[model samples]
Every structure is written in structure tokens, then in C-alpha cells.
Target: MQVRFWGTRGSLPVAPKAGTIADKVADALVAANGRSFADKAAALAFVEDDLDFATGRSYGGATSCVEVDMGEGPFIVCDLGSGVRELGLDTLRRCAQEGRPKEWHIFLSHLHWDHIMGFPFFVPAFMDGAKIIIHAGHPDAEQALRRQQEEISFPVPFDWLKADIEFRTLETGREYEIGEVTVSVILQHHSHDSYGYRFRDRDGKVAIYSTDSEHKIDQMHDENDFAQFFGHADLVVCDTMYSLADSVSMKEDWGHSSNIVAVDLCHEAKARRLALFHHEPTYSDADIQRMHEETIRYEELTRDTDALEVLCAYDGLCVEL
Candidate 1:
């Protein structure tokens, strides 16, 4: 199983800085990982002129989105933030190049605007005979998508979308199957009710995608629930939208967890790998590096049990399990 981050910034998209060391590292990492570094570099270059490592300004844009390819018959995507626009275009190119019809399954955690704003811009919706299934926790799943189709907001209507689309409203705790993947949904604590999903392939490779959730004061009180929900997960993508200090101060009850809290959850759940996700919009790449270092330090401090390997998530980051 493989997971690829199309966009990682929470709440908004962040722009690239000119000739920054971090940008170079990011480009190098993409090349090392078999992605198109030249194209990425070109894109960054077109956006900036001066190439300073320090004193460079970091830019910001849209929210969270990710794609998970199980190497099976169908592809699975999480959330539908502005990142989905790129995901859709890429999917179209891949399908045309392979001469196959597009087949995709999208899992939505909730109907928040930041999570669904890119749906209309998604290129696949414009293709004829494309197959897309949307699975979400909203009781009014279709309504949520339809709300974005109003003439006041968009020139095109949902009915005008050319793809063959299906919407499935899921209930909490129900397990469902798509091709070789089995997915189970769990309720999470958020501003409104949200969902955390667990996907297990036939080979027992497990992945849990849980974001937009807040940990209660009795942090470990529901540990057993998560243990059962995410037991033995190979990868866990969790919400870590705040620092310990920030979370303890004003961000508490903001429906998000701090890095430490997410790491603790990974430990309690016995997850093999934990990917910190849903970055705060205000956090720069350097800020993310500091958070990553702190998370690593904490992971090492609690490494006696070897519970989980902690890492941070960035756009275009990919993980194989």
C-alpha cells in the first residue's frame, strides 16, 4: 500500500520561497523519490526570483488532501480540499496515458468548505464515463455536494457534471468493502461530528486516517477505543495542528490535537508509523521542521517500547507499507 500527500497545509495552501535551502531540499527529495523534480523546480522558479536560504518568505494558499493507491483495481482518496484539483488533473493524465477508464473512491471526513472546495475544480468530474464513488459520514451526503452547485457560487450545476458519480452515506462503526480494501468508519470529536477511517487490505496492511479530531482532557480515557479501532495499523495519519503550548493555551477544544497528543495516541494504538498531519496555516516550513524534531525527540524518549515511528507530512510526501 502507498499513500501520497497531494497537499498537507491545513486550512490553506502555502507557496514556495525563492532559492530557499528548504525548497532545494524539497526538490532534491522529490528527485530522490522518483517524482518530477525538474517540473517542480520550474514551477517554484516561475513563482519566485531571489533564491535566498534565509530571510526568504514562505507563501500560503489551500487545505488538506491526500491520495492512497492500494495497487489494486481502484484508487482511494482522502478529503477533497483544493489539492483535489491537482489530484484530478493528474488522474486524468494517468488514465489517458494508460488508456483506461478512471475509477476512484473518495472518503470524506466531513462537509467543511476547506475539505470540499476543490470538488468542482476536479477534472474527473468533467469527463464522460468516469466512475467516482463518494463515501462520507454526513447524513445528507448528496446535499453537501449539491450545496456547492448553486449558481451564486458556481457557474456550472452539479447536474452538469459529466462523470458517473455515486454517493454513499456511511454510519459509524460499519465496515464496507471496495475491491480488495475493507474500510471501517469511527466517529470523532470535532466542531461537528467527524469520522476517522481505517482501511485494511486483504494482506492485512492497515492504514488509519484520522484528522480534524480533538483529544479530550482525560487523554487516555478512550485509549481502548482507539486501540480497537486502529490496532496494529501500519500507518496512521493523524491531526497535529498545534504545539503543546498552543494547544494548552488557546487552541484547546479547537477540534485538533497537538503533536505530543497524536504521538501518544500512536503509542497507545501500537501503530507502526505515525505521520503528523493537518498542519496549521501559519506554520512555516521551518516551523514544521522544529515540530518534527520535537516529535522525534519525544518518540525517542518513549522508544523503550518501540511503539511507533513518528514523522511529519509534507505535500508530495509518499509512504510505502
Candidate 2:
């Protein structure tokens, strides 16, 4: 199984401004001052080894769409954020090139605008003969989606869509088989509540997607049911939308977790890998990179026996398990 992140930001999308790009260019020039290279490879090597990731690359701007690849069949995705538009285009190209039927399974955490805003733009939703299954814990999931495409907001009404779209609500803790994958949902701590999904393939690879959820520091040491939900996951895609201080001090009950809390939860859960997700929207690329480094340091200080692989999720990141 492979987990791909098409978007990673929380709340809303954010693109780098012109001034940011110019700053990076200027930084790169200053770093290269009086330096000579024999070939492009040498210059590139220097940049890779010396230059900061924020100065050369971005964590990206798209919000919450993720693709979970499980061999062949219909595509399975999590959330329908702005990034889903790109996933939709890619799916269209693949379907057209291979002459295959278009089908998609979307699992939504909640109906927050950032989570469902991309559904209206999903090309498959507008294509004839396409099958789209939307799974959620919210009973009004279907109504929320339809409301987004109502005549008041979007030009195309939901009823006018050409695809065979169906919405299903999953019973918490019940496992459902979607193709060869086994999926289980768990209620999370968030405003209006959210669902965290655990997907396990036949080969025993497990991936947990838990976003728009918050955790309390006082709950970390206790034996938690949430840890069981994340147990032994090969990859735990978690909400890390704030710093530890902020998540606890000022943002209490804001329905978002910090990277430190994510590490603690994954550590308690015995998860093999932890991917910091749901990045704070106001955070710059540099801030995220520094926070990622801090998370690693914190994990090192707190880890007991097994070492967990830690990574910061970015748009276009693909992890194969």
C-alpha cells in the first residue's frame, strides 16, 4: 500500500508571495557567492547539502486531499480539499489513456469547507458513468456536499452532476471492506466531531488518517483508547496544526493537535512511523521545517525502546509500505 499526500495544509490553502520567492532567490545567490562549480551536479550538490529546504522548496499550499493506493481498482482518497482538483485531473488523464471506467471512494473527516471545497471541482463528479462513493461519520454528509454545489454558490447544481454519487455513513468501530481493503472508523475529539480512519490491506500494511482532532497533554501517559485505534500502524497521518505551547495554552479546544502530541500518541500506540500533518496555515516554510526538526528532537528525548520513523508531510509526498 502507498499513501500519497496531495495536500497537507490545515484551515485553508496558502501560496508563497512574490516577495517570498524573491527572498529565496536572493538567499540562494548570497549562498553561492564566489563559489565555482565544475558542472550542474556540483552546484546542485552544494545547494542540497548547504541550502535550507525553505530557501529552495516549499511544503506546498493545497489543503487535505490524500490518495491511498491499494494495487488496482477504484481510487481511494481522503478529504476533498483544494488539492483534489489536481487528483481529479490526473485520474481523468489515466482513465482516458487506459480507457477504464472512472470510480472514486472519498472518505471525509468532516464537512469543514477546507475538507470538502474540492468536491465541486472534482472532474469525475461531472463525468458521465463515473461512480463516486462518499463515506463519512456525519449523518448529514450528503446534504453538506449538495449544499456546496447549490445554485447559490456554484454554477453547477448537485442534481445536474452526471456521476453516480452515493453517500454512506460509517458506524464507529465497525470495520468495512472496500474492495480488498479493511477500513475502520473512530470518533475523534473535534468541533462537531470527526472520524479517523484506519485502513489495512491484506498484506497487513496499516495506515491511519487522523486529522481535525485534538489531544490533551494530561491524557498522554494514561492508557488511551485512541492509541488502540492507531495501534501498530505502518504510518500514522496525524494533525499537527499547532505548536505544543499554542495547542495547550491559547488554542485549547480548538480541535487541532501539535507535533509533540502526535509523537506522544504514536509512541504510545506503537506505530512504526509518524507523519506530521495538518500544518498550521499561518506557518511559513521555514517555520514548518524548524518545527519538524524540533519534533524529531523531542521524539529522541522521549522515545523508550523502539525508534519511530518521523516525517513532515508535504504536498506531493508519497510513502510506500
Candidate 3:
């Protein structure tokens, strides 16, 4: 199985301002510093090797959608944020070229607008032969989505969509087999209650998708529960939307975790790889890169017997399991 992040931003989508781009350009030029590039390849190499990620690349602006592909079949995704529009277009193109039916299985963390707003723009949902199955732990998931598409909110009504869309309410703690993947959910700490999902394939490869969930640092809970839940998982996608200081202070009840908390949880859970997700929208690419570096340093400082691989997720990142 493979995991792809279509969007990684939290809260909402954001774009770099013109001033931000100008700064990157100025920084790059300063880094070049009187060097003469013989050709485009030389300049490209300089950009790739010498310049920092903030100057050369961006983490992107799309909010919270991910794709989990299990070989060839229907598609499984998490969230339907602004990024899903691009995913929808890509899926539609692929289906058209391969002569395959459009089928999508989407899991929602919660009914948050940033997470569900892309559904209205999902191209496949407007197609006649497409089939969309929306899964959520909340019983009001369907109604919440429908309300967004009502006359006053959106130009098109939910009932007017031509696709066959169904909503399924998930039962927490119970595993359900969806195609070749075994999926189970757990209630997470969030307003209106969100869900964290664990997916285990037939080969026993595991991936946990946990977003919009906050972890309590001061409170003591049975470590065994989380350890068993994340037990030997190959990858854990976690919310690291704030700094530890912010998470504990001003944003105490913001329903988002910090990289410090994420590292600690994945370490205790014995998860192999941790992907920092649900990036704070206000953070620039450089800020996130610095945070990633700091998280790695923190992990080293707190390492126990085992080593955990850590990475900061970005839009368009692909991981094979």
C-alpha cells in the first residue's frame, strides 16, 4: 500500500504573498553571490543543493486530504479538503483513460469546514457513473455535508449531484474490511469528537491516520491503550499543528497537537515511522522545515532503546509501505 498527501495544511488553505516570493528570490540571489552559472542545469543544481527548501520549494496550501492506494481498485482517501479538488480531477482523468468506474471511499476526521469544503468541488461527485462512499464516526456527517451544499451556502444543491453518494457512520473500536484493508476507528479529543483511524493490510502493514486530535500531556492515561492501538504500525500520520508552548498555553483546547507530543506518542506507541501532519497554515515553509529539524533533535534527546524514523509531511508527498 502507498500513502499520498494531497494537502498538509491545517485550519485553512493559504497562499504565499508576493512579498514572500520576493524574499525567496532575494535570498536565492544572495546565496548565488557572484557565481556564474554556465547553463540552466548549473543554476538548477545550485537551487537544489545550496538553497534551502523555503527558497526553492513550498509545502503548498491545500488543506488535509490524503490518498491511500492499495494496488489497483477503488480509491481510499482521508478528508475532502481543498486539495481533494485536484485529486478528483486526477482520478477522473485516470478513470477516463483506463475505462474504469469512478469509486471513492472518503474518511472524515470530523465535520470541520476545512475538511469537508472540497466535497462541493469534487468533480467526480457531479458525474453520473461515479460512486462515493463517505465514512465518518459522527452520525450527522451526511447532514453536515448536505447543509454546506444548500441553496444559500453553495450554488449547487446536494440533491442535484448526479453521482451515487452514500454516507456510512463508523462504529468506533470495531474493525471493518473495506476491500483488502482492515479499518478501525477510535475517538479522538476534538470539539464535536473526531476519529483517528488505523489501517492494516492483509500483509500486516499498518498505517494510522490521526488528525485534528489533541493529546493531554499532564494527564496520565493507560499507555497500553495507545501502545496497542499503534503497536508496530509502519507509519503514523499525526497532527503537529502547533508548538509545544502554544499547545499548552494560549491554544490549550485548540484540538491540535504539537510535534513534541507527536514524537512522544509515537515513541511510546512503538510506531516505526512518524509523519508530522496537519501543518499550521500560518507557518511558512521555512518555519515547518525548522520545526522538523527541531523535532528530530528532540527525538534524539529523548530516545529510548529503539530509533523512530520521523518526517514532516508536505503536499504531494508519497510513502510506500
Candidate 4:
């Protein structure tokens, strides 16, 4: 199974300013310390491996889209955030090269505007002979999508879409066999509620996608339920949108989690890896890198029988198992 992060931002999309880009360039140059690489490959390697992620690359600004491949049927996508536009174009290239299917199965966590805003710009929906199957815990998913494409809101109507689109309601706490994978859903705490998904491939490799849900820290039962949902998983993509102080005090009940809480849950679940995801929009790449470093340190200090590998998700990052 391969899980690729198309978008990693939360709430909304944001772009770096000119000064930020200039700063990265200056930092990269200073880190070189007057040494020059022999070739472009060498220079690129130095940027990728030596420099900090904030200086060498970006965490990206698109909101909440992920693609999961179980090596059978169509690829499963989580959310349809702004980054899905690029994913759609890449899917076109993949289809041309590997003869992949034109069918897509998109699972939505909720009916938030940021999560579904990219549907209008998705090129595949404008193409003929394409099939799109959208599944969500909310039965009103279709209504929300159609409303977004209304004449007053968008120039194109939902009925104008060329691809055949369908919506399916998913029951929480039930596991469904889809293609070569078994998918389980868990109800989460959020505005109007949200749903987290767990996917187990034929090879028994597991991946959990849990975002837009607030985790109660003092509640052992809630923690246990989430831990079970994440048990023995290869990867757990969690919402780490704020500092612990912010998540608990300032943004309490705002429907988000912190890296501290994520690490604890993953540790309890005995998961192999935890990918910090759904970055706060106001945070810079440097802020996220610092948070990532702090999370690693926290995991090290609180580790039990085994250590959980910590990863910060960036756009275009691919985790293969």
C-alpha cells in the first residue's frame, strides 16, 4: 500500500511571501559555507538531505487531500481539498503511463468548505467516461456538494459535470470490504460530528486517517477507543493543528488535536509510525519543523516498550509499505 499526501494544510490554503522565499535561499547559501557542489545532483542532494526541511522545502498550503493505493481497483482519496487539483493532473499522467482506471472513490470526513472546495476545479470531473464514487458518514453529502456548485456560487452547475458522480452513505462503526481492502469507520467529536477511517490491505498492512476530531485527554475510554482503531497500524495520519496549550485552552472544542495527544494515542496503540498532519494555516514552515522536532523529542521521552516513528507530512510525500 502507498499513501500519498496531496495536501497537508488545515482550515484554508496559504502561500509563502516573497521574503520567506528569499530567506530560504539565503539560509541555503549560508549553510553551504563557501563550498560548491560538482553537479546539480550533488547540490540537490545537499538541499534535500543536509538543510532543514523549512529551508530546503515547503510543507505546502493546500488543505486536506490524501490518496491511498491498495494495489487494486481505483485509488481511494480522502477529502477533496485545493491540492486535489494537482493530484487530478498527476492522476492523468499515471493513467497514461500505467493504464490505470478512470474511476475514483473519494471519502470525505465532513462537509467543511475547505475540504470540498477543490471539487469545482477537479479536471477529472470535467472529463467524459470517468466515474466518481463519493462516500461519507453524512447522507447530505450530495446536498452540500450540489450547493457549492449552485449558479449563485459557481458559474458551472453541478449538473454540468461530465463525469458520472455518485454518493454513498457510510455507517460508522461498520467495516466494509472495498476491493482488496477492509475499511472501518469511527465516530469522532467535532461540529456536527466527524468520521475517522481505518484501512487494512490484503497483506494486513494498516493505515488510519483521523482528522478534524478533538481528542479528550483525560478520558481513558475515548483514548482506548481511538487506540484500538489505530492498533498495530503501519501509519496513523493525525491532526496536529495546534500546540497542546492552544488545543486544550484557547481552542478547546474547536475540533482539532495537538502533536502531544497524537503521539500519546499512537504510543498506546503501538503503531509503527505516526504522521503529523493537518497543519495550522497560520504556521510557517519553520514553525512546523520546530513542532516536528519537539514531537520527536516528546515521543522519545514518553516511549514505552517500543518507539513510534514520527513523520511530518508534506505535500507530495509518499509513504510506502
Each candidate structure's TM-score, on Cα atoms with residue i matched to residue i, is: 0.85, 0.95, 0.95, 0.97
Best by TM-score: 4
> What value does the lDDT take at residue 289 in candidate 4?
98
lDDT of 1 at 154: 91
What pairs collide in candidate 3?
Answer: none
Which candidate should be chosen as best, given lDDT against the real structure? 4
Q: Model 3 off-target regions past 4 Å?
A: 36-42, 98-100, 220-223
Worst 10 residues of 4 by lDDT: 215-224
* Residue 155 displacement in candidate 2 (angstroms): 1.5
Better of 1 and 2 by lDDT: 2
Per-prediction count of colliding residue pairs? 8, 0, 0, 0
Query: Quick one: ranking by lDDT, best first?
Result: 4, 2, 3, 1
Per-residue CA lDDT of model 1 for 163-199, tens digit only, reads 8999988987678998779999998888767899998
lDDT of 3 by residue, 182-282 (tens): 99998888999999889999999999999998886775264456657787889999999999999999999989889998888888888899999998988
Quote the positional error of residue 231 for candidate 3 in Å: 1.5
Cα lDDT of model 4 by residue, 108-226, tens digit: 98989889999999999998998999999999999999999998999999999999999999997688877888998998888977889998998899999999989867664657889
Q: What is candidate 3's local distance difference test score?
A: 0.90
Clashing pairs in 2: none
Q: After superposition, how far is residue 28 of candidate 3 from its true place, in Å?
A: 1.5
Q: Please write out the lDDT profile of model 2 over residues 177-239, one tens digit for every residue.
A: 888799999999899899999999999999999999989887775538789999999999999
